[model samples]
Target: MGPNMLILASAAVLLLCGAANAARILALVPVASRSHHIWNSALTVGLAKKGHQIWALSPDNLEDNIYPNLTQMVIKGTYEKLREDFTMESFVEDSPFTFLKTMWAFGINVCRYESSTQAVKDLLKMPRDFFDLIITEVVFGECMFMFLHHFGGGTRIPVVGITAFGMGPWTDVLTGARTLPSVFAFPILPYVSKMSFTERLQNTLLTGYHWNNMIREYYPEQQKIAEEAYGEPLPPLIDLASNISVILVNNHYVLNGPQAQLPGIIDVGAMQCSPAQRLPKDISSFLNEAKIGAIYFSLGSNLMSELLPKDKLEVIVATFASLGPGIRVLWKFDPKVPIGHLPSNVLLKKWLPQEDVLGHPKTLAFVSHAGLLSTQEAIYHGVPIVAVPFFADQHTNARRLVELGVAVHVDFLTLTKESFKEKILNVTINPRYAENMRKMSNLLRDQPETPLDRAIFWVEFALRQGNDGMKALRSAGFDLAWYQYFLIDVLAAVLIAIVSPLLLIYVTMKTVMNKLRGNSKSKKKKL
Candidate 1:
């Protein structure tokens, strides 16, 4: 009851509040793919290690359940199982057309799953008073954005958007940057590689238009729910750049090209906190004895190694053969290798400790599909890569790494023993690639705090800021229209309207004056 007592009690309360604010973080990751799950799981584990509470909402999985200080809400069923019924050959008879069909189908399937999942629906419909900071995977179909807009309810807990791949247009827009070309929207035609300046511009515009339309088609109910939840007008597109405070791309600046002008987007690059798991004892001993180092081959989780055509498989095998005895091959093949003459140094496993093998000093080069996680892992370990991109954003990731001077790209369809051999040799044998990779490795590792620490710090910061952060996020999505955003179209239309009427009136007056002059001349002649 005394004044001094009251003041002391109030100070204690304020100090406790500050402590709680600094320790809380909620990460919502609804990733369905195995590779995506692994990447997200690593982040969750890292954040947990930093003493932050993690609220993970993902489909049911082994890793999600096991993470410490983490609560997981799993959506049932595996995406791979669903794809077994939907075969690639059924969708695209030709090889060239297959990648596009696969990507589109994959996106659609993910969207459908998210939209229909009971857990997602229930979570969105619940009263929005849980979790401080929401970190959602950007490519969780369309629902990630929907949840951010709906459950987020325009309160600023600092929605941090995590991208498994590089910063695409949607991510860029969310992070307060100007729009860029959509790699997903562009046509999958081979000639796309040879497109001219005008053609590329046309493709870019068309891609944006298609994506804008696609978002509407995928989540019509999101806008209505968001408006109701937030009690304000929502942006037309569900995934607006401004809704996010931080855009954390799982790419290193060294491998990815120049940074886009978005201040909010940060390249954390693979965020490999744990070292590679140790290789099996037998494999390890083999690696140690191999003088020339080992070639690590993996098609990633999404692409089954058994699915490749016989010829394509042979090309890979033969390339390993040409590398000679000094180089050992560790291939992650799904099924046991078909009965054939196997190379003496080649080692095939149903599963191998990929990161561990890559981290090993003996890992000469990585033969990969250029998936974002794999690329990041290779880069993090300073190992050069020979990227044979299969589908999705793999091509773009490959291009980015090659541009970074640390990786060589070998076209999948046109691949041969010679090309594969040449690529592997160029990346592994050349000191330049290793040196460039080392430089990037240094940049990736140069952060003042570990990526885990920074990520944890931001998450807690967002939570502490709360509603103020949310309002800032919503305001970031503010845009008038195409006419307003660009203004050039409006200017051109106004100029055309004004000029057309003036030119028409002048022409009419001249015609009438000419006719009157002719009449007067005839009268004079008659006189």
Candidate 2:
């Protein structure tokens, strides 16, 4: 054959081989947040590129899928509901407990809505063995796994769980991973991995509350929804959830602090992050023109910066206005939320390519809400941060950034023009923040295999192994009760074994002493 024909023939053979092994996979991430969609879609699309048929169900379409093998279905109204239900005001005004309750309510509501969607209904009509594998978000969407059980037709198809952000203790139970509350603080709290005694106590209590609530209140509601949707009784969701073969969590020891993870639990954090792309002309020009440096501020996709309270917004604007004339500001704001004029040096866009902005040579500091994805992106690009954490894990993420010496955190509730400006200046001008961030970025990038490749390999591994084969990776702790897993029973037995002999010796000695005393008294009386 001619050289050209030979090359084409070889390429065709490779494509055919890939197609032969292609599996039908479903990606269900019902969370309405854009960040969640981004992480989940990254995996599904990557799988599609490998020639697998991927069907993704999410709240955001994440633009049209570029891969022809990937099909995306949007869960209608979920995003709209999120925007209406959670606003900037809610983020700012809600206390920690209030925020937890709000999340609980929101999670259950979304789960119900997701199960009722027409798209899901159609999916339900497919053949029992239509899919080879199922990948769904584990947090708050456990009910979605009912599809796995349904499609398995008495035997569940191999399933993988994905957590777009930090893995919660509740989700860790899926792989029987130990959650040391003392070492791993609860996500909502502002404590780092190394915590004080009081912090650990609080973390333990809050972690218990989350686990308890999920089992008692959350699971029952999710179970009801699943049963209602299936129109038949199903196994308990906790049981179904435990059947998850593997979970790809968007967390790494470098960013989230080191901890023990079960073999079944894989860390694929920053998989959604990539090398910066070339910035758009306008954004590139804006950053390049900065005589000193530029600050990129975003509240991420969930919170809208335009909804900042008038007084607070004024304080922020004044702080930005006070920056050196040479310094520039690129702020992401919603065009729909009209706002008063900003400083001349400040430029606002409805959307900005965040990774590119962070990657820009002139970019000095990132002013962010500290969402996990944004934090990961900043780490990927080696950018320092001024974190203004409003709610959720933002507090914890901001605290970790400070603990790592790569960011300064600002309390939104106590934000003042002076404090905000000082934080911005501290992060931008200080050499430590940038230096520390560079070190962290190196650590995150130094892994042997790219996170995306590692994730895809494990996914394909699970498919090849099947559910039965995947069980070898599951922790034996999965079958253990909480007390048993902690070895409370073992400890109790050991304690009893040691204490029983000691008690017996003490009692025998006492009895002998009493008898000796009695004998002495009787002899004295007889004499």
lDDT score of residue 463 within candidate 1: 61
Cα-based lDDT for every prediction: 0.65, 0.84
Best by lDDT: 2
In model 1, the runs with Cα more than 4 Å from the true position are 1-26, 60-68, 85-104, 114-128, 144-153, 156-158, 172-177, 182-199, 221-245, 261-264, 273-278, 335-339, 473-477, 493-527
What C-alpha lDDT does candidate 1 achieve relative to the native structure? 0.65
Q: Which candidate achieves the best TM-score against the true structure?
A: 2
Model 2 alpha-carbon drift over 4 Å, by segment: 1-17, 92-96, 153-156, 510-527
How would you encode candidate 2's per-residue C-alpha lDDT over 142-214 as one tens digit per residue?
6687887887711566888888866787666677776889898788888888899999988888888877887
270-303 per-residue lDDT for model 1 (tens digits): 6654567777898799889888888888988767
**Which 10 consecutive positions of candidate 2 have the poorest summed lDDT?**
7-16
